[model samples]
Target: MTRTFRRGGTGGAGGDLDLYQYAYLAGGGLRVAESAVVSLTERGTLSLGAARLRVTGEERPEHPVELAVVVACPRSKPVREVIESVGHSSEVDVIARRLVSLGLVRRWRRKPTRAGRRRLADAASAGQVPAYALRGPAALVPGSARRGPLDVHPALGDLGRALTRMGKALDDDRGHGTDSSADAGGFGGGGGDW
Candidate 1:
């Protein structure tokens, strides 16, 4: 048996909203078992376990930098450099603070050598920023292998279809002005809105 999944954006603020597709194949039998879309909007619909639900709430920032730091694990680069590299200039301090609070990264002062200390003293006299390293995770490194369930039961087809419908309806209600039904063919017409 083999399982396949695809992820894409659902078109919203910062293009952070996303949609997912899950399908399973076994002995030449192919079935789509799930379709879900999540957004940072006020109200949307979701299908879960034979239930169609209307969800409403504020979307919170997930601090995407944390993931970037994780992927760059074992490399403790400077915080300012990390922010610049990740293009999070405006939220640099906030993201750094959040990551430190979550224990995902550690900030530390670089030990100064004799010559480095002289330069630091000169820079301090000139009011330059202090240097710090944003460390990555200690236990789990990127590309580490892990295992989990491969497929959802074929019996959940109805639930999958329901979820697709809800997603389409929500998209339509948002006036995105695109027909996602045609795109979501395999999951019974609950395709995503780019």
Candidate 2:
């Protein structure tokens, strides 16, 4: 099984908040393995099965540069640029730290992958804002983020109607003599009444 890690940021004070999503694939298909929100300030190690990792985060001198370094990312880039790729830098750092703590991700001397870089590019292009990306003050609970369910997804609408009809039928069946009397009536009127 393979897993994916990701981060997102929010605006204002506390920097970015980090979050991760893990996907597990088996003979059936793909499914969500695990997901969580993490904090940026911490040092720890993680061990997932045979894999082991260590990570650390500390504030740096260069504003954006420091943030990137704390996340063990090489080179300097704007906060917006970082946010674009991984989400908020702070959030990403927190997630990285969490990975360290959880044993999912660790700090070590290793080269980045083309797939990882591509994932960053996709994150950037998606324009996934920070508010909904992280937890605590920054992250917005997905379901509560908007007013309510859209009820406009076509299939969902149909399902809603079907459920409504089913409910009405259930109510009718559960009622007293009214349903039985109604059923007894034939064509234009009841047999004896006609």
Candidate 3:
């Protein structure tokens, strides 16, 4: 479905996203690489060797991630190297751009847009996401992105706490605010803070 994105870039919810998009949602490009490995292994097109992944079948890859993995495994490369190669390949960029265009992922960063989160939730509920592909820190965090600057920058939460500390340190903790005339050392006075 066609989606029109708002200027702030949290994006609007439209419909379900694909498995690769879901992988991107959970763990960026690395997760996509892991997923391609699992798919290839399950299909018997790829076999794992001693510290390597060897192609056993002549099956042509159809997906970008799959193609990247297959192309990198021409001679049974190390498993780690193969995954890393595909993780950093142009194919991941292509997947990322498609997600960005669909409003499922933000540009530049690997963060899923708000609508993208909904798409992930949809996939989860439908059991479209393979359980083996998601776990640990890379797993999807439930709920919408935090509000305000925190939504745009996860690190901004720390800045917000710092601002609170500044307010408390000024004895403005009582909500006396800038008009308290308590003298904020000229750093936080004049209603500069919200």
Candidate 4:
């Protein structure tokens, strides 16, 4: 977990990154997108509901991720579609590349570097980020996580439920193959004729 830096890059992007970076390092692009949505809707800049997300004001978001969400929803669009689209858009990719250059993430495997991990840990400890966000995508993987009530922002109750449904749909799409032969052999070499 130790990373040696060059002469000037000691702090790894000026000692620490902002909250959005922490969210991305903790989970992925989706986490950042979700956080932005919560913040925007809470401020009344955006209206997020189960069916649609609409921009209500000209509130230009400070974060690139938030801005991307706004751009994606120029008109009233399905909340699920907007969140997923913005989460996987070019904005997140740009942030990923920057994290790599800053030595906060490995280029290929895409795991956090030492500094990245420490930053996220510190942010989580300080309550700057949510515990669920720190849990990464697993926390959103539908049945994998209990369908308990989420204590989210008042304006984001819809967002929370939408995210849950989205995760369930993704989980279902991964494997609904009931045929015994479809996934009979475990994904291990030992299951083969060894």
What are the lDDT scores of the predictions, listed in order? 0.26, 0.28, 0.61, 0.64
In candidate 3, stretches whose alpha carbon ends up further than 4 angstroms from where it belongs are 1-16, 136-194
Q: Count the backbone clashes (under 3 Å) in each candidate.
A: 0, 14, 0, 0
Error of 2 at 84 (Å): 3.4
My TM-score estimates for the predictions, one after another, are 0.17, 0.18, 0.60, 0.63
| Tens digits of per-residue lDDT for model 4, 66-166 | 88988989998766577689878888888788888888888997778897787666667666565445664336433353233455323436556655544
Candidates sorted by lDDT, descending order? Answer: 4, 3, 2, 1
lDDT of 2 by residue, 39-108 (tens): 2211111111111111333333233322433343343322222223444345444544543444433345
Q: Which residue pairs show collisions in model 1?
A: none
**Regions of model 2 farther than 4 Å from truth:** 1-88, 109-194
Q: Between the candidate structures 3 and 4, which one is better when assessed by TM-score?
A: 4
Instruction: In angstroms, give how far residue 5 of model 4 lies from its true place.
Output: 23
Displacement of residue 71 (Cα, Å) in model 3 is 0.7
Give the Cα error of residue 91 in candidate 3, in Å: 0.8
Candidate 4 residue pairs that clash: none
Candidate 1 lDDT by residue in tens digits, 1-194: 11111213232112211111011011000011111112111112221222223222233234333233223222433322332343332223443343334332344421223433333244334433111111111011121111111443233344334434433433344354264545755656447696
Best model per TM-score: 4
